[model samples]
Structures are given as structure tokens and as C-alpha cells.
Target chain A: MALNVNVLREEFPILHQEVNNKPLIYLDSAASSQKPRAVMQAMDHYYETANANVHRGAHTLGDRATQSYEAVRDTVATFINAKSRQEIIWTKGTTEAMNLLASGLSQSWQAGDEVIVSRMEHHANIVPWQMAAERTGAIVKVLEINDKGELRMEQLDELISERTKVIAIGHVSNVLGTINPVKEIIAKAKAKGIVTIIDGAQAVPHFKVDVQDLDCDFYAFSSHKLFGPTGLGVLYGKQARLEALPPYQGGGEMIERVSFEGTTFNKLPYKFEAGTPAIAEVVGLGAAIKYLESQDRSAIEAHEQALLKRAEELAADIPGLRVIGEASNKVPVLSFVMDGLHPSDLGTLLDQQGIGIRTGHHCAMPLMEAFKVPGTARASFAFYNTLEEVEALFAGLAKIQRMFT
Target chain B: MSLPNLETFKNNPYGTETAIDDVLENFEFLDDWEERYSYIIDLGKSLPEFPESEKIEANYVHGCQSQVWLIHMQDPADGKIYLMIDSDAIIVKGLAAVVLCILNAKTASEITNTDVEAIFEQMDLIRHISPTRGNGLRSMIELVKSIASQQ
Candidate 1:
């Protein structure tokens, strides 16, 4: 069945609002998606009824909170096909998850050991590795991308060396919108015994992600991007891989036994989750996953592709407008730079017209540098966005070009 | 006390003749954001050609979405400050022009004394000038003010 995007739009209350005297056309979902009423209501319901600390409460509300919160672990494990709930770890967001993995994994790194990351990674993916390398005297290596914004898969063989400790890459390019061939990359890394970490922050939203099939040791994503609440993310690690590493944080939840000499850490997922976690956010994420499961994901994917196709077609007609990333496989993200207009100017003008698009380096400065443009105006579409909104974006761009050029 | 290309700074007419009041009046004539932004873009285009050499780290204004370069010189001859600004984004450059118009060609105390936020508020451009936009207009104004205070 064809996805009724107009009906889907009703689920997201934010989509109906007006900005700058015009109906809001939210195209910055890549930055952060607009939340649905279900997700919001779930969070509100959790706070109203089951608001209590998890794993410690003897009271009824405690059991309810713990049950709902722990249930999300099972939901997420199934969502990504993780081995068990033990592999699911709650985090502040993908950034913190990367930091956890990077810090925990880097403890074993020695001098001259290498960590390979793609040029297309968000700073969240890159910076943590750099900091890890700084601490361990490990060298951070680059997996270069071609001019077409696709990873040079051939270079991966050459880039992988005997001393390569970890291979961290994004499953999708946040800026270029290129859905990277991470499965292939992960296979090579697995063969070499190098731990593979996939940044799935941008990928999990647009499509289904099966971590086991991909064979990636670690997969990290934020709940906000997945139509859940903010300040919550998930790190799905292979049970063995997580158990081998030291605990990421030391706090009440992550503790097993405390003594003056040393403290033993909790097992698997709890070993990483130190503090009192975002209990409400965990419940909300469960609802988000349920919401996604309720939808026809394949249809949503097709609809998003149609939106991108329409955007590309319209972009072709606009004089001086050039789509930055033309990778054969991508999500519904249109990143473009005009001949004479700066992206910030385009972004500002688009905002005035009630079109919310992302402008600037998009936290992928290396990719931006490779593209040889300062930045690109990005209009990222979600499943709820209508075809008319796509048309309005091009219309707004045309109006902006007429005004400036 | 002096900056290179003093002649370049003195020739620009943003704060000297093109006062903030004139800009406010021109903005008042425009009805909508489209017209106002067009006028702002025009104002950006009117900026004197900034020397390519001066677009260096020393003059770069941080915290903007677009790359912005701002250089100011207090004229020893006239006892007044002269300012020049540029940005990769035309709207930001236009915003820089607005800042230059209000704060340029003034004495140290006068430049420091100007409430650029008030002027922006009056023009209904408070949103653009907000620190959140990261347009560097706020940083530019802060830089101008700091430069004036140091003088």
C-alpha cells in the first residue's frame, strides 16, 4: 500500500505549525526529526504514571518504570537484531556512545596501532577516535571517499594493516546522504579481527538496520533521530565484544560490588550505563520503535526516494544549482550549492519562507573539504513530509535565486 | 594606532554618511522579509572591495555559520574609527554592513557606547543578529566594541 504521507503528517503536531507567516516545511530532519504525538504521549504517560528510578525501586511505580525501561532493551535488541538485551546500552546520544566505545576499546591500543575512519564521518565519529589515538599514541587513518561522494572501497584493503585496531565509519554520510557500503567494509574488518564500529545515527531513521547481518561489532544511534525523545541513544555491541572491554563509566547502576581497594563492574549493558539513565526517554524510545514497527517501512522508504527524485529533478531545472552528492544509493537528502549564492544566505532566505533547511559544514568538514565547497544547503526529508513540501522547497529556492541572482 | 590599507577603510561610507537612521528608514519602507532581505543584499553588494590579503586569521570573526572577516582601524588623522567587513554569505555581509553603518567613523567612546542590539531590535532584525544564528553579526559587533575599548 502507498504510504499516506498527509495522514502521517497529522501524527507529527510540529509539521502543522506555521513559521514566518507560512506553513512550516520541515526539511531538517537529518539534524533532528520532529517528534510524533505517540512518542510525546508515551513520555508524558511514563512520567505521569510510572515515574521512578529503575532496577532499585521496591514500590509498584519502580517495577513499572524498570519493566518499561528494561523492555526497551529487548525492543532495541530485536529492532537491530542484536544477540540479546545484554548488548543494548543506553547513552546520552550517539556522540557519547562513540566516546564510550572509543575510550573503552582504546585501553588496549599500543603505540603505532591504527584506527581507520572514513572521510565522510560526522565529527562525533571522528573526534572520539582522534582523542583515543591521542591517549594511546595510536594513529588515526583516513578511509578516503571519491569525488562522487562514495567511499573508495578499493582503498579499504590498502588502508587495513596488521596493526589496525579499529575501523570506525558511518553507515550513511550525514552530509552527502550516501548510504555507505558498511556491510562490505565490516566484513573485511571482521576478517582482519579488527573491531568495527558503525555510526548508524543517520541510517536507523530512514531504513531498517540489522546489526547481526552486517556483522558490525558495535552500532550506535540516537533516539531523537529515530522519532524518540532527546538525551537518549543506544549502543548495540556484540555481547562478547562488550564483555571484553572495560566498563565505560563507574556509577550506581554500572556497579556490581564496591570496596576500598577496587570495585567490580556490572555485566554487559549495565556495565556501560553508569548513572540513573533517562528512564522516561527509554520508555519513549520503546514507543518510537513500536511506532516504526506499526508503519510499512518499505513504503516509507519508497516515498522518501520519490521525494528525493522530485528534488533532484527540480534541482536539474534550476540554473546554477548543483547537487553536491550524486551517489547512486542515498536517502532522501538533497544537498546542493548554487553558483553565486552562499548556503547560509539560502538557508536564511528559506527560513523566512518557512522552509527549514540545514546550512553549513554539516559536522562533516572533511567531506565538505573533499567536495571543495564551503557548505551546502541541505533539505532532508522524512516519511511524514509530503511531495508538496518538496515542491515548495524548490519554489522557495527559485524565489531566493530570483531575489539574489 | 594604524592598520595597513588605511585609505581602504576611510573611503568606505557605512558609518560616516550611511547612518543607522538611514538604514532604519530604508528598512521601514520595505513591507516584507523578501523586500527587506533584497535591500540588505543590496547593502552587502555596496561594501567596498575588501583586500584579498586582509582575509586572514587575524581578521576572521569566529562563531558564524559563514566565514566572516572584519578589520577595523582608528584613523590617526581624524580621531575616528573606520571599519570594513566581509562575509561569504551575502546576508551576513549585509548584516556586517548594518553593523558598520552604526559603529563606524566614530570615536573610541562613541563606538563602544553604541547599542547595536537596540538598533537591530528597532529594525526587527533581532532574530538575525541573535547569537544562535551564528551569523557572526553578534561576534562582529562584540569585536568592534572590544576594538573600540582597546583604542
Candidate 2:
């Protein structure tokens, strides 16, 4: 299956706008992808026709809404190839999803139990675990990355021991785009009877994910990065583990039998969903999943690979432009710093041309400390992005260099 | 006609597109950063309708180029929220005017649905700012939404 770039471009309405009298060149998909017409239409259709609340009503619209809402669970279940739809719990994106596990796992973990996380994790994955470790008196062990931004697997192995209760890592780094070996890491963790949680926020949108295949204890991702609406994501947990854990929130939907005496929680997914979920966003997420399935993902990956190669080739010759995270396995994220120009300054110049890219620490401060820079300019890619945009970005960077000089 | 100048969006009482030509025409007339700085400061002086009493801690924007205070009041007569903004930086104050135009006198949904990038194009606003300042603008908008979503 090959990606049809032109056809895919047509689906995203925002791609045609002009910026600074020039066509807008968007290269910040890592932050968030633009929604296609299908996703937009699905969200619109839901609001227009099926605006009723899900799972608590007896009316026809309610039934339809509930079915559509639950259909997304099945979609997510299949999307990640989870063992069952029961394992897919809707969250307020990956941040909340990771926090849920951090807080939830803290209940069972003892003070001396260790939790291992990578230095490359976004603040979302890191901070919650840090808080959890602080609250529970558990040890927080950080795995260091090499200069090229690849996680030192030998160092990682040395850190994970019997005392290590959980290993938290990102599948693909948000800043460096270093695709971590989560499957291998999970296998090792499982061998040691340790729980593993993978932050799939950066990975799930770019590649196909199969939770069962990876055998990870928990997997999380956000909908916004996958060309869907914000405020929606999934926390995929194995059924046994999910059933064993206590509910994160005490609310209307999650309770099955509530009495003055005691409360019995609902099943796997609803037990986790304590309040009214982001229904519209979830519907939009389903539309996004459908849109992605319609496309040829293998082709998307290949196109992105070609773009990454081109970006690397063009940037390699620049005297001061040193690409960060030169890992063997990486996605199409290019984080770089030039000698004379600050990354922030370069980003400002690039924006003058309406070239949208992200700069600063990318919410990975420790990783920035490791690199010994304030920050790097990051240009992330999605399937909708094109080679022309890449060229325009470089052209903008060149113009920026000349202006600064 | 040439596109709107940085000063046009800077000192306006509202974000209405006026004095675009005068600012753009005279943009290059100023030679150094000192004159440009004064020009930007003058632009800040033209900021409109800021309610000073509303500059409380509740409305302060995080991760901004300057300390910006924002207050949103829902008008009982028409369900629209009136946003009054102030910032420590003169340029930031002018930038706040740019944000207020589309955001002020609008419903919560309107603020959320507004195509900020489109507004930036119409005003040629985003092309001139630093990236951190741009992100700061985004952060201000996000803060607005966070408040609006609750309301």
C-alpha cells in the first residue's frame, strides 16, 4: 500500500492557506496533525444527528450514540490490536493516561519499589512518575541516553532489577524521534516479572501498534497527534491488571452497584472512565482511525522516510547545523541547533515565512541537559507533509542564517 | 496596497485593520532599533479597553514574553464574554490587542473555533514575532480556552 500524497493533501482543509503572501508550509505534525475532512465530518455528523449522551439513556439517539461511542473502543482495540476492547480505556490524552497509571500503580507499589524511566520522556511521562515516586517513597531510576539520543540499553539493563516494579519509556521520543525498542524492553521487564508502560504518544500515530504483540503491560497515546480532536486518548491495559487495580475516579458511569455500605466498580473500561468522556473527541478519534486505515500506512512510513533522508542530506552540509539524536532507528523528527543562531531565533525567522515548526526544550528538559544546549528547533513530519515543504523549511532556514549573519 | 505593518496590530484599541498603510509605508523610514523600539512602544500606547482592575493573578498567562494579565467577563445581556487584557511589555500589549479582536465579544465556542492562523494571515501578525513570543501567544490563547471551557 503506497501513500497518495496529493489525494491525502486535499483532505486537510488548512493546508491551502497563505502565510506572509506565501503558501503555508506546516512541518509541526509531531505537536499535532491537521485533521482530514473525514474526521471533521464525523465529528460534525455526531453533533448534528447523534448528540445524545452515551451508556445511560433508554432513547433511540442514546442507543445510537452509545453504539457509536463504544464502536470507537473496538476501533481503538483493533487499532492497537489489544486482546480485548475491555483493555482500551479512554483518557484525556496520554498525559492523563500516564498519570492514571502513575497514581494507580503507586497504590500497590511499596516505598522501596523502584520505577525506571528514560531521560528522553516528555514531561508528561516523567513528572507524573516523579510525583508517584515521591508520594510512595519508591525509587525513581532514570536510564541515560547516549550523545546521539539513543537509550543506552546496557545502562538500562543495569538499572532494571528485582526491586524495579515498573519500567516506563516512550516508544518514539518526542524530541529526538529515537524509536525505542519497547518490545525488547517489555520482554526483558516481563522476564523479570516487572510491569512495563509504553508512552505511545509519539509512536502510535506514526506506526501500527499491536499491544498483544508487544506484550506491554500498558500502552498510551493521544488522539490529537493522530489527526483527531484533542482531549481524547486511550490507556490500554491488560484485563487482569485493569481488573485488579482500583478506580482512578469515583463517578457516575464507573460504578456498577453503589450502596451506603460499599461500591462495586463497573467492568474493565467503564470502571476507568469515571465521568462523562470527551464524547465528540472520541467520535472524531474514530473518524481519524478510519481515515488512517483507508490510507496505506506502509507508504506513509516510506514517504516520511524519504523526507527524513532528504532533510538529513540537506542539513548535513550546513557548517553550523548539527542534527541532534542521530540514532540508527528514528522517525521523521529533525532536532538541530546552528552555531550562530539560537534555535528560538531560527524558529522565529522560519515563522516569518509561515513555516510552522516547534522550538525549545520540547518538554524534555533532562534530555536538553544531556545535549548541553538550551534547546533545538524541531521539525516533525506526518503523511500529509510533502517534499516541497521540506525544501521551503530549509530555504527559510538559509534565509534566517543570512539575516542573522 | 502593501500588507498591514507590525504597528497596525500593535497600538490599536481593538484588532481592527486600520492605519495599515501608514505603518507599513513608514516601516523602513526608521533606521535603528531605538526608533523601532519607540515605534513599537507608541503602538502599545494605542491599546484599547483594558480593565485595569481585572489584572489579577487568576488571569496571568504562563510562558509569555511579558507578564500578561487577562480577565474575561460574561455579559448578561448577550452571553458573549468581554476579554480585557494588559501586558508588561509594550510590544506584548500591542500583541494582546491582536488577540483581543477575534477573541473578545465572542462566545466560548467562537473563541475555540476561530482559525488563529487565518487571523494571523489577514493581519500578517505571526510573520514578525520570535518563536518563543509566538508560543507565548499560543499559551495565552490556551489559557483563554481553559477558562472558557470551564465557563
Candidate 3:
């Protein structure tokens, strides 16, 4: 069946609400996606019917909650083709997930050990590694990006070596939407026997992620970005790699046994997941996955691609508007700078039209520094966004452009 | 030509922890941009006490639109971090205040260990601010943590 997203849009009641006396045109999915009714109803249902802690309870509610939570893990494992549910660890979001790996892996890294990242990484990916490098004598080597925001793979190959212990990269640039050749990046790292971590926060929602195909040692993404709930994310690690790393936190559930002297760690995924998990959100995520599975994946992609093209065409025609990243391979994310207006000023004006677009560095300040601009106004797309919405954005931009010019 | 009076700008408690949600649930309740600007600046005015000496170059927050100073004083007895903050911009000062209440007076370990998510949830802070302003607030929290780590 051909899935019409507008039919699904009615499910999200928030979408219908007017902002600033105008209808809401949400264009910031890269930051966080709007939850469909299916996702929302699933979350509400969990709270209403089966709000109980998972795995530890002996009651009927616990069993049901545990089932719902594990079902999402199964969905995630299958979605990414992970070897087992043991490979999936729940986290607060992508940032915490990345930090989990960083905290767990830092003890193994020596001062001279090399970690590779790119200039285009969100602060979440960059700062954790920087912290880890600071603790150990490890050195963080950044792979440069061209003006189009494409990762310099040749530069990456030169950077990785015998001393290189980890290659941390974003699967898709959050600011630019440039899809990195992570498979190629992983293959190069694998040749050196180095571990690879993919920040899939921007990639997994927009594109299909087959972790088995990519062969990345660790992959992390937020559930909210993939039309799921906030405060929940997934970190997929190869079982062996997870087993090798130390426990990220000293907490209730992550331990097999604890004594006055020392603590024994639990099995693979549980070792990383400490304390209470986001049970309702995980159930909501399972529903979100089920909802996405029910849709035609290619159709969604095609719709977004069309929107990107329309956005590009309209954006380019604006007299003073310059689209920031012009790469051949990109998602529908567009960052732009107008002739004279500050990004904040532009954002405020756009809010008046009830069109929401993120302004500033998009948390990739180094990329902004590389581009030699203060910041760009970023508008990202999801499957639900339409060409008409893109037109509204351009119309809004034209007003700002006229004012500035 | 008459310009709007800056002093008359009152900070409504709406997105902050203290906002009267029922009375002014939406931004549109305010008549014009001038009123909203005044309200936001007024929100900045509510920022808690920041030590004057802490205003030195060392305490300056890097990414803010205004000059912001932060000083972390450790209470020798309890080992909690006492934060005093100030900012040149009214809105930023308000932002600093909101941050101080959530973070200040907590132990270094508490500051390090607390789940910021819960505090943000209680404050209902993120949804109301401009995305950039929200990011700046996060940066301020990060700066606070960086200080606590040093302490």
C-alpha cells in the first residue's frame, strides 16, 4: 500500500496547532522528530495500562513491561541486523550513549594511542573523545572536511595507523546532512585492527542502517530523531567489544555482584545499562519501529528527496541567500546564510510566520569555524515535511532577504 | 521619536520554574515584540546572586551574546559548590539565574552526578527558549560542570 504521510500527520495533534497565529511548519527533524500518533498512543497506552519497571519485578505488570521493553530491543537488533539483543544497550540519548563508550574505553587508551574523528562531528561526539583523550595520553586526530562538508577519506586513511585505537565518525553530518562513507571508513579502520564508532544520530532515522553490513564496532542514535520518544536512545556494540570494555557506571542493575572489596559486572548489554530504563519510551520506540516498518521505506525516502530538491531550487533563487552545504550526497538538511541579518534575528522573524528552523552552529561549531561564518540557519526535513512547507520557508526567507538587502 | 522604555519591561515567570503557566500560557498574550523583549529581559533580571570578584576574565562564558561571569566557591565544610554568576545582558542574567538554582548549592559530586534531565523537566525551560538560547543555556551548564570538575 502507498503510505500517505499526510494521512499519518493527523495522528500528531501537535502538528495542527497554530504557532504565532500561523500554522506550524516544523523543519528541524535533525534536532528531534515529531512523534506520530501511533508512537504517541503507544506511549500513552504504556502509561495507562502497563506502567511498570522491567526485568526485575516478579509481578504481572513487570512481566508485561519487560516484554514490551525487550520487544523494542528485538526490533532494534533486527532493524540494524545486530547479532543479538545482547548487543543493544539503552541510554538517555545519543550523547550519553557516545559518552558511555568513551568512559568505558578510556581506561584502555594510553597517552600515545590515537583516536580519529572528523571536523564535522556534533559536540556530543567530539567532546566525549576529547575528554577521554585528556584522561589518557591519547591523541585526537581530526579528519578534515571539504567546503561541501564531505569527509576527506584519503585524509582519514593517512591519519589511521598502528597506534590508532578508535575511529569515531558521524554517519551523517547533522549540520550539513552529508552522508559519510562509513563502510569505507570502517574498512580502512579494520585493516589497522582499530575499533570504529559511528554517530548515527542523523543517519539511522533518515536512512536504513544495517550494522552487519557496515561492520562498525559501535553505533549510537537517539530514539527521538527516528520518530520515537525522547530520553531514550540505542547503542549497538559488537558483543565482544562490549565485553572487553569496562562498565560505564557503578549502579544498581549493571552489577552481577557487589562486595565491600570490589564489584563483579553483569553480562554484555546489562553491564552498560545501569539503573531504571525509560520503559514507556522504549515501548513507544517499539511502536515507532513497527509504524515505520508498516510504511513503504523507499516511498518515504523518495518523498524527502523531492522536498530537498524543491528546497534547493527555491533557496538558490533568493537573492542574498546562500545554501551552506552543496554536496552531491545529502539528506534534506539545508543550512543557509543571508546577506546581512544575524541568525538569531532571522530565527525570530521566522518564528513570527510559525515556521521553525534551527539557527546557529547546529552544534558543529568547528564546521562553522571551518566555513568562516558566525552560524547558519539550518532547516532539516523528515518524511512528513512537504514541498508546500518548503515554499512557506522560502517565502519567509524572501521577506528577511528583502529587509536585509 | 519615542522608543520603548527598558525599565518598564517586566519578566513574566512563564517558562522559568516560577512561571504562572495558567495566566500566560502562550507568548502571544503579550501585545507586541517590544513587550516580549521587555519580558525576556525582565526574566534575565531575576538571576540569582553572582559574586562581583568572580566577574574576572576567568569566569567569562565564551559563547554568550553578553559578557557573563561565573565563580564557583566550594564550601569547605560540606564540599558543595556555591556558584555566583552575572551577565551584561538581562536575558542572559535570567538564564544564569535559572542555572544557579538548579546547580548551585549542590556538592561537587551532586553537580557531577545529578541527572540534568530531571531539572530541565521540572523547569520546563527548553521548549520556551529560542534554540540558540537553549544551546547557550546548555553551554552555561557545561561551563558550571567544568568548574565543579576543577573544584
Candidate 4:
């Protein structure tokens, strides 16, 4: 059966509001998705009934909080098809997860070691590795992308060498919406014995990602982008790789025993998750995953693709408006630049029309530089977004173009 | 690069001819956001031609979603500050024009004392001046004030 978008839209209460006296047409889901009522209710329920710290609390509330928090690890592991729940380490967000992996893995990186990252990566993926390189004298190599906004896979062979210690790449481009061929890259990196880190922040919201099938060393995603509460993320590392690497942070919950002489770290996941975790956020994320599990995801994917198809069709009729990414495989994201107008100008006008879109570099400055555009106005879609909303966006754009001309 | 043309800054009529009161009255005349924004965009279109050479890194204002360049000169004779602002985004340019109308051709003390925020609130344009908006209107005001103080 087809996805019932009307029913799905009912689940997100924020979709029914009006902004600037017009019905709000939200198209900025790539930045952050609107949380479902179920996710919010789960979080509210946790705070109302069981509000306590996990792992160390002795009371019944503590036990409930601990159970709720720890169970999400299993959910996440199953969601991403990781081998074990021990591989799921809680993080503040994908940025923190990347920082953790970069700092921890770079500890073994020798001078002149190479860390490979694609040009299409978000700043979160690129900056962490760059910082790691700066600290350890490791060299950062770029795998370039073609004008089509797809990674130039041919360059990867020449970029990789014996000294290449790590390969970090985004599973999907946040700005371009290109679903990268990461599984192939991971396989190649695995054959070379190089550690692989995939920034799955954009990918998870759009499709199913089986970490074990991809054979990636580390995969990171933020809960906020996954229809869950903010301030929580997951870092799914291979069990062996995580066990071998040193702990990223040290604090209350992460320590096995503390003494003046030396402190031994806790087991697999706890060693990296320091202090009190985002307990409420974890519960929210678990609820979000459960909500997703209840849905027909393949149907959702089809609905999203149909929205994109209609958008692209309408976009082509508008003169001098160029869609930025033309990759064959992409999620429903439209990054475009209209001639004789700046992106922020478009953004402001669209906002007046009660449409929300993201303008500027979208935190992918290097990608902007590569495209030779100051920035592009992006309208990203989620499953709940109706075809009517897509039409409204185009109508708004047409009016804006007419005004500018 | 050549120094900024003092005559261009001195002759600009943002504050001197186009007062904030006049702008407020015009905004009140407009009924909806579309009319208001159209008026603002027109104001942006009326901004004096900014020199391309002046658009260097030194003149750039940070924290803007769009690129913004601001240059100021204090007219030695009148002891009033003169300003020039430019932005790639039309809305930002419009907001910058509004800022220029408030701050340009004012004495250092006068520029420092002007309640720009209150004026923006009165004009119902408080959102544009917000730092979170990332349009650089707030930063432009800061730059204008800093230049006025130095003068």
C-alpha cells in the first residue's frame, strides 16, 4: 500500500500552524526534522514518571531511567544492524561522535599518515579530521567531486596509499542530496585495511542503513535529524574496532575504578559515554525508532521520491533557475540558484510567503567553493511533506522571480 | 586601492534627507509584508553605487548569511559620520539601507545615543535586526557605531 501522507502529517503537530498569516509550508527538514507526537510524548512520559540518572542510581526511578536509556542502545544497534549493542555509544550529536572517533583513532596516526575525506562532506566530517590532522601531523587528502555533485570514485585509487590510515566520508551530501556509494568505498577501504568512518547524519532519515552490511568501522548520526529529540546522537562502531581504540572521553560514568595512581576505563560503550547521558533524549530517540518501525518505510521512500520528481518537473519550467545537484541517486532535496538574485533574498521572500527554506552555504562552504556559487537556496523534504506543499513552494518561487525581474 | 570618495559619503541622503520618521510613516502606510518588503527592496535599489574596490576583506562584515561590506567616513568639516553599505541579498541590502538611514551623517555622540533597536521595533522590523537572523544588520550597526566613535 502507498504511504498515507495525510495521516503521517497528522502525527507532526507543528505542520498545522500558520506563520505570517499563511499556512506554514516547512521544507527545511534536512536542517532538522519535525518530531512526531509519539517521540515528544515518550520524552514527556519519561520526565513525568521516571526522571533519574542511568547506571549509578539505586532507586526505582533510576532503574527505570537506566533501563529506558540502555534499551535504546539495543534499538539503535538493531536499527542500523550492528553486530552488538555494545558497539552503540551515546554522543551529544554527530559532531561529537566524529570528534570522538577522530581524536581516538588519530592517537595511533603517525606523522605523514593520510586521512581521506570527500569534497562533498559536511563541515562536521571534514573539520574534525582536519583538526585531528593538525594535532598529529597527519595529512588530509581530498577525494574530489565532479560537477554533477557526485564523488569522483576514480580519484580514490590514486588518493589512497600505504600511509592512508583512515577514510572518512559522508553517506549522503547534506546540501546536494546525493546518496553516495559508501558501501563500495567502505569495501575498498576494508580491503586496504584502512579504518572507515561514515557520516550517516543525512542518510538515516531517508533510508535503511545496515552498518554490518556496509562493513564500516564507525557510523554516526544525530537524533534531531531522525525525528527524535535534540542533544542526543549515536556512534555505531564495529565491536573489534571500538574495543581496540582508546576511550574518547573520561568522566563519572565512563570509569571502571578511580584512584590516585591510575584509573581503568569501563567496558566497550561506557568508556566513550562520559557523565550522565541525554537520558530523556535517548528515550525520545527510542520512541522515534519504534514509530519508524511501525511505518511502511519503502512506501515512505516512494512518497518522498514522488515529491522530488514533481518538484524537479516544476523547477525546469522556471527560467534561469538551476538545480545544483544532478546525481542519479538522491533524497528529496532541491538546492538551486536563480539568476539575478541572491539566495538570502529568495529565502526572505519565501519566508514572507510562509515557506521555510535554508539559504547560504548550508555549512558546506568547500562544496559551495567547488560549485562556484555564493550559496544555493535549499528546499528539503520529509515524508509528511505533501505534493501541494511542493506546488506552493514553486508558486512562491515563481512569484519571487516575477518580483525580482 | 583608492581612498573612499568623501563627497559620495557626504552627499548620501540616508539620514539627512530620508529621516527614520519618514521611513516609519512609509512602513505604517504599507498594509502587508509583501508591500512592506517591496518598499524595502525599492529602498535597497536606491542605495548609492558602492565601489567594487572597497569590497575587500578589510571592509567585510562577518556573521552575515550574505556577503556585506561597510565603509564609513567622518566628514571633517561638519563633524558628522558618513556611511556606505552593500549586500548581495536584496533584503539584507534593504535592511542595511534602513540602518544607514538611522546612523549615517550623524555626530559621534548622536550615533552612539540613537536607539536603533527601539526604532526598528517601532517600524515592526525587529526580526531583521536580530543577530540570529544572520543578515548582518546588527553587525552593520555595530560597525557604524564603532566608526562614529573613532571619528
Best by TM-score: 4
Looking at model 3 chain A, report the run of 10 residues with the lowest lDDT sum: A396-405
> Comparing candidate 3 with candidate 4, which one achieves the higher DockQ?
4
Pick by DockQ: 2 or 3, better one? 3
Q: Tens digit of lDDT per residue, candidate 1, span A1-405?
A: 999988888889988889999999999999999888999999999999999999987899999999999999999999999989999999999999999999999999998999999999999999999999999999999999888889999999999999999999999888889999999999999899999999999999999999989999999999999999999999999989999989887889898999999999888788998889999999989999999999999999999999999999999999999898899999999899999999999999999999999999999898888989988999999999989999999999999999986
Q: Write the per-residue lDDT of candidate 4 for residues A239-342, one digit (tens) a residue.
A: 89999989887788889999999999999889998888899999999999999888999999999999999999999999999999989999999999999889
Q: Quick one: ranking by lDDT, best first?
A: 4, 1, 2, 3
* DockQ versus reference, model 4: 0.76
lDDT tens digits, residues A103-159, model 3? 888887877999999999999999999999999989999999887889877797689
Clashing pairs in 4: none
DockQ-based CAPRI category assigned to the predicted complex of candidate 1: high
How high is the lDDT of residue A367 in model 3?
92
Task: Please give me the total number of clashing residue pairs in predicted model 2.
Answer: 1
Q: Per-residue lDDT tens digits of candidate 2, residues A1-405?
A: 666788889999999999656688898999998999988899899999998889978898898889889999999899899889999999999999988999898998888899999999999989998899999899989998998899899987789878999999999999999999889999999999998999999998788999999999999999999999998888999999898778898988999999999999998889999988889899999999999998888998899998999999989867789999899898999999898565655665576588989887888989989999877899998888898889888887776665544
Model 4 ranges with Cα > 4 A deviation: none
RMSD of each: 1.4, 10.5, 10.3, 1.0
CA lDDT of A349 in candidate 4?
A: 92
- Native contacts conserved, per model: 0.92, 0.00, 0.00, 0.71
- By the TM-score metric, which is better: model 2 or model 3? 2
Worst 10 residues of 4 chain B by lDDT: B3-12
